[model samples]
Target chain A: MISSKWVVLVIYAMEDGPVRYGEFSRRIEGISKKMLTQTLRQLERDGLIERDIHPTVPPAVEYRLTALGESLLPFMRQLKTWAAANLPLVEAARTRFDAQSLAE
Target chain B: MISSKWVVLVIYAMEDGPVRYGEFSRRIEGISKKMLTQTLRQLERDGLIERDIHPTVPPAVEYRLTALGESLLPFMRQLKTWAAANLPLVEAARTRFDAQSLAE
Candidate 1:
């Protein structure tokens, strides 16, 4: 199964168009090389991305989101928007929940 | 930040309405008691759910999704639908990718 967070991150990161492996590595910060490789492979396996290898001196490679992958963006974007807008509400709730429990 | 998978699962599982702690454990097959509690707390803190405690011999508690949480269902359902429909394609891609690596 796909790691949903990485799946969303990679797909959203590649939203523009094709990106080479090194470029993807550069774009998403804090992703370990192993995790990045694994996430890419899994996304490829899931048909969310197409990895194209060009036959060159060292074989250049690139990645892009597939139609299936693009299909997820609208929903992902909406969630991102919702989260951003409601963060303060969520934080306030956490504060209240903690204080209530502390008093009990 | 939310643990997206559990957030989705718990929200979807509670789509019906309010549910008690013990019942939530029963409904979600693999969630441990500790994990269930933690996930619930996080969701509550996020203001996605309202947890109500009734006064009784012992306190009875129940959970229900808030309007903000229900607002996400449309997008979630679409992704779920897309995933279900394209699962075969993803499986095929994985098999081909694996076979390709093995052959190389």
Candidate 2:
């Protein structure tokens, strides 16, 4: 579940508060409807998120992170912070690697 | 590099100290030689690992984690610890979800 690239994206999208399905699609750019549905189901099944249905003319569905999921936020945030800070270094390394590879 | 499953395995294998290529092949089960080589190259290019070659009749080579890589250890370890502690909960949730899906 953690290995899925979409997992982190989806988790972060919901970091602020409960989110609707449509909102998730909009917030997480480049996610297909099928992938979003699948990711949400997987997260729910993993007990990381909870899906709630509100009674209305058309039942509204919202997803929020569970306590278990909330517990993961710090770790994910740390990784994200590290990535944000170090991405430039990675890009520079990639450029050098590609250049050397071409030279060889 | 972080998304690649083999990356973590290789990093952990080298966690204790420097490890030979052949030893990595042995320690990380089911990793193809090609995949291992590619992963190591990527890690080295990302500056997360250093490859050292020793002069010998049949030269010796070993891979070790770099400072940046060492910095990532705590975060990885925390995730590993969380996974170890919560895996059973996830498994239980999966079983429940599967059964519920079957019933539906």
Candidate 3:
């Protein structure tokens, strides 16, 4: 669950506060509506996010991170930083490993 | 890749340095051999781990975190800390959300 891209990005997108369903989908590019809905429901179930439903014409739905979810932000930011810093090294390692395999 | 349990634990198990294949399996409870193998291959492909094969009667296979993988440990530890601290809150949120769903 912690390793899920949709879960991570959904939580990331909502970190700034309430986000509508449409905006959420747009923020996480290449995500299907079905996948977006699934991730939202799962995140909500896990108590990481809150869904707000308004009594308007078509009904407004927005998501915000819960206190629990907010607590995870610093950690997420750290992971993001670590990944960014090591991406080049990781890529180089992959290239070396792949070439070694092809040679063997 | 980052979200895989086997990947996390496999990496976690090696935080202390190199570990044999058997030790890796034992360290992470409930992971199947097939899944473990797959995770190892994927992690190696991504340059997060290195697999050392030694010449022995049956050959020795040990896994160790790459420099890139080691760089991720601090971030991983932070994540573990956050998860521990917020677990109760997350669980409570889940309970409330579940009850609400049942009622709806």
Candidate 4:
């Protein structure tokens, strides 16, 4: 569930604190309403996030990380760090591999 | 690419030493040949694995982690560790969420 690219961005948005549905839509650019809803539902089902429904005019919903989700944050951050640090090398390798494939 | 489930299993298979294609197909049960080939090619292009071909009557091909890939092993292992440790909680949370949903 967490492996999805949307999952990563959603989790990152929740890093600070609880985020309402509207706020999530705003914070994560390029995510359609359908995708955001689906991601949130999946995270909630996985027990990585809690969905709070406020008893208001329209029942405002907010999402926050559970303890399990919070624990996963550090590891996810590490993966992000690795990606940022090594992307150049990875790109270079891809270029070389493509060139070699063409030669062969 | 790293998020692919096949990628994780493939990396794990190469942890001890270089692994032959047949060995990988055997080690990771249920992974189709097409998937294995695709995963290997992707890893090769990303510079995370080295595909070594040895000259013989029938060319022997092996796959092993590159230095950059080795660096990523620890972080990947940590993710595995976290999953192993917290799976029960996640499962339990899911059950609870499901039960509550049923009532509502």
Candidate 5:
């Protein structure tokens, strides 16, 4: 569970800088609030992300990648690049194959 | 849907030669038979895998990568390398954090 989404989410979220919960949720589309919280907690638990809280009246918390999380950025970037470049070809293949199947 | 799992499955399955459905399932460990069939169909549809049917007394079907699928191998290998190397640290971080949470 954590292995799947956290890798992508953590990399994506931390690419900018220290992000608040709302900011993190907004960046990764389709992740539910509950799942975003879960992923954040898991990442913090796993030492990939650090949660910082300010001592103030309201409350401020921000999340940033630890050394370990930063290490994974290259690999995640590679995956994202591959996905973006090849998606069209893959989609074309699907369309052709589906048409062939329907014909048969 | 297909993009997520199919990438990993096709890469893992095609590391060897043309694989049968059963062999592919066995190698992946946790994927259900239904999901395996679905993934294979998706890959075939996507033009990443080619299904070869042999003319024999019974029936023989094998799957191999098309030119596109072969192109993804290097990127997948990088991801696999990163995961295997970092899993231990990630697991250790989880343990330390969990212990800290319990103490607090």
Candidate 6:
């Protein structure tokens, strides 16, 4: 499986203490609802994320990282930094590619 | 786009100079033919990987990284090292999760 998606999901889910499904979906751009739900379920099943459902007139659910998920923060931070720094180059490559393909 | 897959594709394509489609496919495990073709097309469109077509009795195509693609090697290496080192922990978490779920 592509771990980068999981990494991004983990990072975004833990940005704040705990996040509701809608809040989590809004925070991470470009992720389909299906994918977000699938990822969350996988993470929960893996024990990296915990889902707590409140028992009330209206049920509310929240997700938070477990200790295991917390351990991935440093690595995620490193990846984020690397991606931010190098994104320009990748974008440039894309532009050059477009120009060349147009010429062809 | 998930750059990790691109990173892996670039690394595997450039592992030993230029690689043919079949050779590239064989090297990267778990990638479907459709995904591999899709990835290669995307990479080519982005100019990170160059595809060379040979005119022969049986047409042959090869892929190699451009200079931009080579620059990604360092980042890929870092990710590989991180994954290799941390994979055991992730596996352990999976086992723990499975056991706990079984118990529950």
Question: Which tens-of-lDDT digit does each residue in B8-79 have in candidate 6?
Answer: 754656856888888866777787888788788777765568889999769999889887667666656765
Per-model DockQ against the true two-chain complex: 0.55, 0.61, 0.72, 0.71, 0.52, 0.38
Q: Which structure is stronger by lDDT: 2 or 6?
A: 2
Compare candidates 2 and 5 on lDDT and give the better one.
2
Tell me each candidate's TM-score: 0.80, 0.86, 0.91, 0.88, 0.80, 0.69
Candidate 2 lDDT at B7 equals 83
For model 5, residues A40-88, the per-residue Cα lDDT tens digits are: 8878887788999977657888899889888878767776787788889
Which has the higher lDDT value, candidate number 1 or candidate number 2? 2
Greater lDDT among 1 and 3 belongs to 3
For residues B9-88, write the lDDT of model 1, one tens digit per residue: 78888787888878887787788888888888888877788889989769999899888777767766776787788888
Candidate 2 lDDT over residue span B12-59, tens digit each? 888889999889988989999999999999898998898899897699
Location of the lowest summed lDDT over 10 successive residues in candidate 2 chain A:
A1-10
Candidate structures ordered by lDDT, highest first: 4, 2, 3, 1, 5, 6
Q: List the residue pairs that clash in candidate 3.
A: A3-B3
Model 6: lDDT to the true structure: 0.71
| Order of quality (TM-score) | 3, 4, 2, 1, 5, 6
In candidate 3, chain A reaches a TM of 0.87
CAPRI-style docking class of model 2 based on DockQ: medium
- Backbone clash pairs for candidate 6 read none
lDDT of 4 by residue, A50-95 (tens): 9889999989998999888898898778878988999999999999
Candidate 5 stretches with Cα past 4 Å from truth are: A1-10, A97-104, B1-10, B100-104
Better model by TM-score: candidate 3 vs candidate 5 = 3
Q: Arrange candidates by DockQ, highest first: which order?
A: 3, 4, 2, 1, 5, 6
Please list the residue runs of candidate 2 whose C-alpha ends up more than 4 Å from where it truly belongs after superposition. Answer: A55-59, B55-59
lDDT over C-alpha atoms for residue A100 of model 2: 87
Best by TM-score: 3
Query: Where does model 1 exceed 4 Å of error?
Result: A95-104, B101-104
**Candidate 3 residue spans exceeding 4 A from truth:** A98-104
The residue-level lDDT of candidate 4 at B98 comes to 92
